[model samples]
Target chain A: MRTILSVLLGVIAVTTAPPALAALNVFACEPEWGALVTELGGDKVSVYVATTGRQDPHQIQARPSLIAQARKADLTVCTGAELEIGWMPMVERSAANARIQPGAPGAFEAASHVRLLEIPARLDRAEGDIHASGNPHIQTDPRNILTVAKPLSDKLAELDPANAAYYDNRHADFVHRWTQALQRWQAEAAPLKGVPVAVQHKSWVYFFDWTGLREIVALEPKPGIPPSSGYLAQVLEQVRREPVKMVIRAAYEDPRPSEFLSEQAKIPAVELPFTVGGTDGAGDLFSLYDDTLHRLLEALGHDSSKP
Target chain B: MNTTRFVIAACAAIGALSCPGTGFAASDQELKEIQQQIQALKSEYEEKIKSLEARLEAAEQAARAAEAKAAAAQTGVAAATPPPAPPPPAQPVAPAAAGAFNPAISAVLLGTFGQFSRNPDKARIPGFELGPDAGAGERGFSLNESEVDLAANIDQALYGSLVIALQPDNTVNVEEGYLQTTSLPWGFTVKAGRFFSGIGYLNEQHIHAWDFVDAPLPYRALLNTQYGDDGGQVRWLAPTDWFLEFGGEAFRGDAFPAANGPGHGKGAGSLFVHSGGDIGESSSWLAGLSYLQTRAGDRVTGADVFSGRDHIGIASLVYKWAPQGNPTQRNLILTGEFFHGLEEGTFDGNRFDQWRDGWYLQGVYQFMPRWRIGFRHDELDSDRLAGVFAGGTLDNLGHVPRRNTALLEFDTSEFARFRLQYTRDDADLTTDDEVLLTYNVTYGPHGAHRF
Candidate 1:
C-alpha cells in the first residue's frame, strides 16, 4: 500500500508540474499569425505555429503535436472565418485546455477583427466549398494585417498583463514599419493596376483587391474543385477573348494548371509567396509583400523597383 | 393769351399722367444713374449665387469622402491600428435569427448492396460466440442505419451531443448521448451518460468516419462491432511535448459482454493510455494500450447463454504519411490492432474456461485526389476447451479463422463517398467470397473528425 501511494504521488508530481519558462505560450494556427505574434511578443512569449506557409490553410489535420502545443498554450490565435473549421475544433477538444476555448479571454480570432470578402449571397453545396462568413484568405492583403494586429496585441496584453506596456510598444513599432512598407509596395505595383490576369484559384482575391488587378478568369471551375482539361480549355478560351497579361498562382498551389494555360496562351505564369516563409524572399512579414510585388512586376516584364 | 395758358397746363398734366413714345419725361443724367444702379444690383446677385454653388460642391465632396471611408471600414481597410476602445468588432455574419439558438444538426445516409458466394445465414466464426450485433449485414440492396446527430453547448462549461440511429425496420436506437466538460482545469475532461468506450483506436469513431464499409473481424468477434454503454469517463492530457493521454471508464454494463445485471453500480470498467507524435512535417503515428474487465451475470451470445467474468486487452497502432504535410494530393494510412480475451464461467450449465485472440492489419493509400485503395487482413485463434466444453459453443474445432479484404473508394467531395469492397473469408470450414458496394453521404453541419 505504501509503494502504491508513492507511485501515485510520483505520477501526480510529473503530470502537474508546469514548464520552467516564465514566458506566455501561444499557439498560432497559421504561419502569418505566427509571424505576427513573434513580431509583437518578441522575447516575452513563445509561439508554436501549427501549419507552415506551404500548407493549405483550409485543409489541415488535427495532428497530435498540435494538440500537445494547444494544451500548453495560454492563448490561441487563428483565422476563424471557418478557415480552421476543418481541424481547429477537434484540436481544441482533444487538448482539454480550458483557457483557449471559444468565447474565452484567451481565444482570439483574426477574422472577427476584419471585414471578410466574398460573402455569398446564397448558401448552397452546389457552389462547391464556400465559407458563408466570407473568403478566409484574408492574409493576402497587408491592410488586414494592420487591422488584426491591434486586437491581437490587446489580447496578448490581456492574457499577460505583466507585459501590457511591452506589447503596446512593440505593436506601435510594427504599425509604423508596416504602414511605410505598404506605401512602398503600392508605389512599386502601380503598373499592375487594372492589369487583367487569370488565376489558378480564388486564393488571391484579397491581393487583387489591394493591387487593383482585375481577374479575367479562374482555372478552377468552382472553389476547391480542381480543373479538368476540358475546364481548362474553357478558361483558356475566356482568357484569349479577354486578353489577359499573365496567369497567377500561389507558391503552394499545383503549378500544372497555370502552366498549361501559360503555354496555351503566350502569357507568363507568376507564382506569389502567399504567406511568410513561402519562399526564400518572403522570410518574414515585411518581405512577404515585398516578394509578392517583385514577382508581380517581374511578370509584367518590368525591372524590380527595389532591392 | 388765356387759350395759350390753358394748353400749356393741359400738356404738363398729360406728361405727368402718361408719356407715350415721347422724349419729354426725364433728363439724360437721371437715365444714366438708373442704368448704373441696375448693373450694380445684378452683379451682387450673381456673386451670391456663385458662393452658394461653391458651398454645395464642397458639401457633396465631403459627403462622398465620408461614404468612401465607411466603405473602407466595412472591408477592414484601415491602414492604421484601430484606436484604443474601438467599436466592438462586428462578428462574422451570423446565421438567421430564427436558428441562432439551434444546435448543430447532421445526418448520415448509408446504403449497401452485398453479394455472397455462400449463404450468409450459415456464417459463423466457428470458435467465437458472436454477439447479437455481430455477423454479416443484410444481403442484397439495403439501407443501413441512418445516424442523426445534434450537438450544442449546454453552457459555458459543458457540451452535449445526442446521436440517434434509425434502422430500416422502423426502429430507433440512441447510439450516443453524452455531456462533456469543456472548462476542466489541468488538462482533465469528464464525460458522463451513454458513450462509446475510448479503449480502442476506432471505437469512438462513428460508422461514417470508417475507412472501410464494415468493421474488421476482430472488432466483430471481440467488441460486438463496437463497445458503447452507459458510462462515465475521465481523461487527462499530460502537459508534454508529445501527445500522451490517460483515461478510465466505469459502465453500468447493461450492454453486451455483461447483461442482465443490476441497474446500479459498476459492472464493467476499463483503462487506456495513448501516446502519439509527428515524425516530421509529413509523417505521424499513434499507439495505445487498453484493458477492459467485465462481470457478467447472464450474457447472451447467439442462441447460447453464459454467465462469466471476462477480461480483454487491446493494443492499437496507427501511422499516417502525407508529403510536406499536404494531404490534398496524396497520402497513406496504416492501422493495426490486437485483442486478447479470456472468459471463465458456466455455459449451458457446464463449467467453461476459454481463451481467444485476434489481430488485424490494414492500410489505405490515396494515390491521387479523391481516390483511395485499401487492403486488410484478419486472423483469430482460440484455445480448444476440454470435457463438457469440447464440441460445444466454446469449441475451437482445431481451426484458425482468417480473412482477407480489399477495397476501392472514390470520394466525390468531402461529404460523400462510394466504395467497392471484396472479402475472402475462411473463418468457417467453407470459404466465402463476398462483394459489397456501398455509398455514404452526410448532410448538414458535421463536426470535424479527430485524428
Candidate 2:
C-alpha cells in the first residue's frame, strides 16, 4: 500500500507541473510586416525580422543562423509571388523542419490571401524576369490587412491552440478597433485624396488605389529604371505642370531619387511604410495600415488623432 | 560550601571507578547519574527559552491584533472603493516567419528574365554557342530563361519536386525531378532518380543561386558534366559535423554534351567528403575533397573511339569581413579556390598525349546586397596534345599548350544575371573571345535543388 501511494505521488508530481513558457518565435521578412506582427502579437511573439525598413527584403542573404531558427520555428512565413526568388530556395533547403517545408502544416506564404497587384500581361520567362503570380508587395493597402487578419488569426490559433480563444478575441477586438481607426484616418485624408504625388518606383499602387492619390510623375523613364538626369528633368517638368504636393518612396528603396525630385519640385519627400515595421508606429499586423495611414496623414499636414 | 564540595569531590572519586584506557564494563549507577544531570540541564535551558519565547509571542500578537483592528475599522468605512493599483504593462511579442500551408500540398510561382550582350570585338558566335550572342542581336531578351518548380511534401517526411524551365538554348526542359530525404536516421539521406550531384560547391547550386550571372570556367574545364548527373546519391553525416557522400549515375551519353563531342559519358559516378564549421565568432568555411569518373563514347577521333578518365582534387579558402556601420555600404567577401584535374584518354589510334591538367583561382566582392562583381584566372595544360588542339592529321601533333583565361562578372539575382568576362585562349587553337549572359527561373514551387 505504501509503495502504491509513493508511486501515485511521483506521478502526480511529474504530471501537475506547469509547462515552461517558450519564447514566441516570429519571423518577418519586411519591417512593415514585422511592425504589424509586433503590434498584433505584442509581447507574446519573439520577432526576428530579416530586412529592416531601410533594406530590401528581395535580396536578403540566407544566413546560417536564420536557417537554424527557421528549422525549429513553430511557424515559418514569407512573402510569396516570387519576391524572394533568390533567397527563398535556400531557406526551404536549410529550414529542415518538415512542418515548415513548402507543404508543411506550419509553413505559410502570406501573399496568397490578399488581392495581388501588378500582374504581368506576358507571363513567360522570355518576357524578362517578372513575378508571375502578381506583384507581391500588397500590404500597402489597409483593406489588404482586413483579408490577411482572418488567416493570421487562424494561424495563431493553430500554433497555440491552448490560447485559441484568446487570439480569436484579440483578433476580433483588433478588427473592430482598426476599422474605426481607418475611418478616422480616411476622413482626415479625404482632402488629400486625388492629391498629385510623384514617385520613383511603382510600389505605391495599393496605397494609390486606397487613397485615390494621383501619380503626377515618375522619376524613372520606365518602371524599375533608376531615374536618369534627363528622366529627372522630365519628371520635374511633369511635376511642375501637375503641381505635386509630395514625392513618395517605399521605405526599403533608396530615397535618393525621390529626394532629388522633391528637392527640384520643392515638395516634401514622403517615405511610406510599404512593408510591416517600416515605420516607427508599425507594430501589429493591423499596424501596416496604421503606419502607412499615419505617414500619409502627416505628410498631408493634418492632425493625426483626437482633435 | 566546603563540606558540599568535599561531598561532590567524593562522588567524582566514586565515579572515577570506571577507569580510562581500559575496556571497562558499563555501570548502570554511573549512567543514571549522568543521564539525570543531562536531563536537569536540558529542562533548565528549555524552560527558560520557552518562557521567554512565549512572552515575546504574546507581545507580538497583542501588537499585531491592535494594528489589524485599527486597519479593519478604517477599511470598513470605505470598503466599496478600492485603492487604485497600476495595471501591469503588456509584454512584447517576439517576431516570427509568416504563413502556413497544410503538409499535403503548397505551391508558389517563380520566374526570371535577363539580357545578354557580348563585346563587339569578339568573333561572331553561333546563336546557340554564345551565352548572349545568340543568332540575332545584342543584349536581347528573347532568349531569357525562366522556370517554374512545383514542390510537394508526402507523408511529412518525403519531399518531391517537378521543374519546367526555359532552357538557355530557347527550349523548356525538365530541370529537376527528384525526391529529397527529410526525416532520415542521423542525417543519412538517399536521393534517387535525377538530381544535381554534390561534386563541387557551385555544382549543386542553381544558376540562379550564383553570385555572378555566368559560371566560373573551372566548373566547365574541370568537371565534364554541366550541371549534374541523373543518379542516386546517399549522404551520411556524423555528430561531429562531418559529411560523407557517394553517388553513381547511369545516364544516356547524349544527356551531357561534351565539348570534345557528344561523348565523355554513358555512365558517371562521384564520391566526396565535406566538413565545415565556424572557426571563431564570425568566421566559417567549408573544407571538402571530391572525385568524379565518367565514361562516354567519343566521336571526335572518327572511326577510332577514345575513352577518357578525369581525376579532380580541390582545396579552397574564403573569408568574409563585415563591420557594423561601414561607410562603404558593402559586404566585402574575398574568396578563391585552387582546383586541379588530370584527364587521360585511351583511343584505338596512335594517340600521343591522353593526360590533361589545370587549376583556377577567383575572387568575388559584393558591392551591394544584390549587386556583386567577381574575377577569375585559370590555366589548362596537357602533356600529350596529339590531334585535338594542334590540327594534326590523325596522329601527329604539337604539345597541347596551356590555355589561360581572365574573367570578370556581375550578378543581380538568381534569375537575372549580367557579366563581362574575357577568356584568354593561349593554346595553339584560335584565341577567340568568349562572353556569355544567362538567366534562370523556377516554376511551380520555389524549392532548392538537392544539396
Task: Judging by TM-score against the true structure, name the best candidate.
Answer: 1
TM-score of chain B taken alone, candidate 2: 0.57
Best by lDDT: 1
Worst 10 residues of 1 chain B by lDDT: B81-90
Against the true structure, candidate 2 reaches a TM-score of: 0.58
Evaluated on chain A only, model 1 obtains a TM-score of 0.94
Per-residue C-alpha lDDT of model 1 across residues B357-407, encoded as one tens digit per residue: 999999999998789999999999989987877777678789888989999
Q: Candidate 2 at residue A87, lDDT?
A: 67
Q: Given the true complex, what DockQ would model 2 score? A: 0.04
**Model 1: lDDT of residue B187:** 94
* Candidate 1 second chain TM: 0.80
Please give the lDDT score for candidate 2: 0.55
